[model samples]
Target: MITDMTQGNPTKTIIKFAFPFLVGNLFQQLYNIVDSVVVGRFIGTDALAAVGSSFMIMNFFSFVIIGLCMGSSAVYSFFFGKKDYVSLRKSVFISFFSIGIFTIVLSILIILNTNNMLLLIKTPQSILEGSQDYLEIIFGGLIFVFLFNACSALIRSVGDSKTPLYFLILSAAINIVLDLVFVVEFNMNVEGVAIATVIAQAVSSILCFIYAFIKIPLIRLHREDMVFDREISTMVAKYSILTSLQQSIMTFGMVCVQGIVNTFGPDTIAAFTAAGKIDSIAYLPVQDFGNAFSTYIAQNKGAKNNERIHEGVKSAARTIIVFCLVLSTLIFINSENLMRIFVKANESNVINLGVEYLTIISVFYMLIGFLFMFYGYFRGIGALNISLVLTVISLGTRVLMAYVLSSIPTLGQRGIWWSVPLGWALADSVGLIIYKRLK
Candidate 1:
C-alpha cells in the first residue's frame, strides 16, 4: 500500500488519502447518531432537544480544534512536501505544546462559568439542567478531544490517514456498546450519553497517540526536534489562528441560529436536530473529499507545483456536484423514510418538518462542496487568511439572516431552516470567485 502521502497521481493520491478519512468521519458521526437515538428513544423529545442544543455549543469548541489542527497540518504538509523531516518534527512539537496551553485555558474558562455561559445562550430552563450536566462532562474531557484531533491532524498531515481511521472505528464501536449499556440498559439519561462519548474519545486518543508514537516513525520526538524554529512556528501560528477564528465565528453563528430554533419550542428543535443529522450524513462524501483535497493541495503546494493544485480544485468541485445531485435526489425521493430513522413521531410532524427543511437545504448542497474545495485549496497553500475572511462573511450572513429572516411571519420557521442552504450558496459563490481570481 502507498502509505506515505507524498507520492502518487493526484487523483489516486486523493482517493487513497480520502478513504480512511471517510471511514473515520463516519465513525465520528456515529457518536452523534448514537446520542440522538439513545436520547430520543429512551429520554424523550425534550431530552433529545437538550442534547441537540448542547451540540451547537460543543460544535463551536470543535471548530477551535479544527482550526488549530488544520494550521498544524498545513505546516507539516509543507515540510513533508519538502522532505524536511527535521522541520516536520519541530512543527509537530510546537503545535502540541501550543495546543496544551490553549486547551488548558479554554477548559478552565468553561468549567468556571458553565452556568453563566449556559444562561447567556438563553438555554430553556426545561432542558437547562440536563444540558448543563452534559456540557460539564464534555468540557472536562476537552483534553481528550484535543488530543485526538491534534494527533490525527499531525498524522494526516504526513499522509497517514488510515491509522487514525482504524482507531476511530475501534472507538466508535466502544461508544455504541457503552451507550447501550449506560443509556439503554441502565437508563443513565444525558449524563450517560456524555460519559459514553468522553470515554470513547479518550480511548481513541490514547490508542492514536500510542500508535503514532510507536509505529509512525516521523512523529517520535527528540530533544533536537523540540526546539521550535521561530519563522516556521510563527507562520503556522498566524495561519492557524486565523483559521481558528473562522471556525469559531461559524460556530458562534450557528449558536445564533439555534437561538432562533429554540423560540419554536422543543418540537421544532427536535425536528431541526434530526434534520441536521441527516444533512450531516449527506454531506459526508463532499466533506470527505474536501478534507482529502486539503492534504492533496498542501503536498502539491509544498512541491511548488501550481498546476496540480489547480487540478485538485477542479476535481474536488466536480466530485461535490455529482455527489450533491445524487444525495439530493435520494432525499427528495424518500424524505419520510429517512427522517423516520431518527425521530419516529406518531403524528409525523417532526419527521415531516425535518424532511421539508432537508429538501430545501439540498438545493444548495452543491455550493457547500464548492466552498470546501476552495477553502481547502487556499488553506493548503498557506493562504488561510482568504478562507478565514470567507468564513467570517459566510457566518455573518447566516447570523444576520437567522435574526432577520426567521422573524418574517410568512416564512417563520421555514425561513430559519431555509437560511442554511441559502447562506452556503451565497457564501460559496464568493469563495469560488475569490479562488478564481487568486488561482
Candidate 2:
C-alpha cells in the first residue's frame, strides 16, 4: 500500500498515522517491559539489575540497525511518494540484505565476548552470570531483531502503520506466553526470558516478511529492479552512518553512565533499574510520535510539500506538548506507586531512590518532547549531521555532569538524577536553536 501522504489534511494524517505508531511502540516495548517485570517479581532485583545493566549494551547494537532503517526509510518514503518504483526496489534490496549480513557478523562478534562485555561494564558480581545468560541469547538472535526492525520501519514508511501494529500485537502476545512458560514452567531462569524474546522476534519477522511480499505490491522486486546502484547506496550510507554514529554515541554514553551507577552500590542499581523501566514506558509515546513525524516529513518533502510539513509539525508539537505535560505530571504525582511495580516490597531503599530518580527525570518531559520532534524533522529531511551533533551534545553533557555531580560528597547518588534534567535542558535548547535556523 503506497500512500501519498503529501495530499491529506496534515494534522489528521499525522494523528491517524501516529496513533498506530504509538500502539506499535507500546507492543514493541512489551518485550522489555515484560522482561523487567518478570525478572523483578519472579527472579529478584539482582536479576532485574542484570537485565537493566545489560540493556544499554543491547541498545547500542539496536542503534546500528535503527540508524540504517531510519536512513533507508527517509529515502524510500521519498521514492514511494514520487512513484519512483525502480529506485525504491533497489533501496529495498540493498537495505534488507546488507543489514542482515551486518547484524549476523555483529552477533557473532558480540556472542564470542559476552562475558567480557559484561565485565567491562562493571556488572556487579551478584548479577554478572544473569547478565551473561541474557546477553548471549539476545546476541545469538541478533539477525531476527535487526530484520524485524528494518521490515517494520519499511512498512510504516509507506503509510502502513496498522499492519505493523498487528504484527507487533501478535509478537508481544507470544513473547508474554513464552515468558511465563519458559520462566515458570521450564525453569530456564534468566535465559528463558531471552529465549522467549528471540523466538517471538523470529516469528514476527517471518510473518511480517511473508505478509509484505504477498500483500504489498511495492515490496515485490522485479528482475530489473535488483541491480546495485552505487550512487543511491552512497547516499544511504552517508545518512545511515552518521545517524548510527549519533545513536551509538548516545548509547555508549549510557553504558558509561551505567558503569558509574554500578559504583554507587546495589541499592542504586536496583532503584535505577526500576526507574529505567518507568522511564521507558513514559517516553514511548513521544518516541513513536517522533518516528511518525519523520516518515510524514520525508514523504511530504519528496512531494515538495514544504508548507504542509511546517503546518503538520506545528500541530504535532501542540499535541506532544499536551501529551508531555499530562504524562510527566501523572508520573510525578504517582512516582512512588509506579516504583512499587518494579521494585520488590522488601526493597524500601530501592523504592525511595527510584522515586527520587523518576521525580527528577519526569520534570523535564517537555524538553524531551521538543527534542524528539526536532530529531525526527532533521532525519526526515536528510539533515542528519545536525541530528548527530545534537545527540553528541546531549550524551556528552549527561555523562560529564553525571560523573561531576555524583562525585560530590553532598549529592552522592542524588546528583545522578539531577544531571539528567540539566543535560536534557541543554540539548533541547540547542535543538530549538537549530530548528529555528533550518530552512
Q: Name the top TM-score candidate.
A: 2
Kindly report which residue pairs in candidate 1 clash with one another: none
Error of 2 at 261 (Å): 0.7
Clashes of each: 0, 0
- Least lDDT summed over 10 consecutive residues: which range in candidate 2? 1-10
lDDT of each: 0.82, 0.84
lDDT per residue for candidate 2 within 1-439, as digits (tens), equals 4556788887788778888888987888877788888888887878888888888888888887777777888888878877787888888888777877888888899989988888897989998988888989988888887777788878888888888888889989999999989887887778999999999989998888888778888778888777779987877677667877877887898888998899987788878878987897898888878888888898888888899888877987998889999999999999999988877788899999999999889988988788788888888888989888888888888889999999999998888888777777888888888787875
What value does the lDDT take at residue 312 in candidate 1? Answer: 69
**Model 2 scores what on Cα lDDT?**
0.84
Off by over 4 Å in 2: none
Candidate 1 residue spans exceeding 4 A from truth = 1-7
Indicate the worst ten consecutive residues by lDDT in candidate 1: 1-10
- The true-versus-predicted C-alpha distance at residue 76 of model 2, in Å, is 0.9
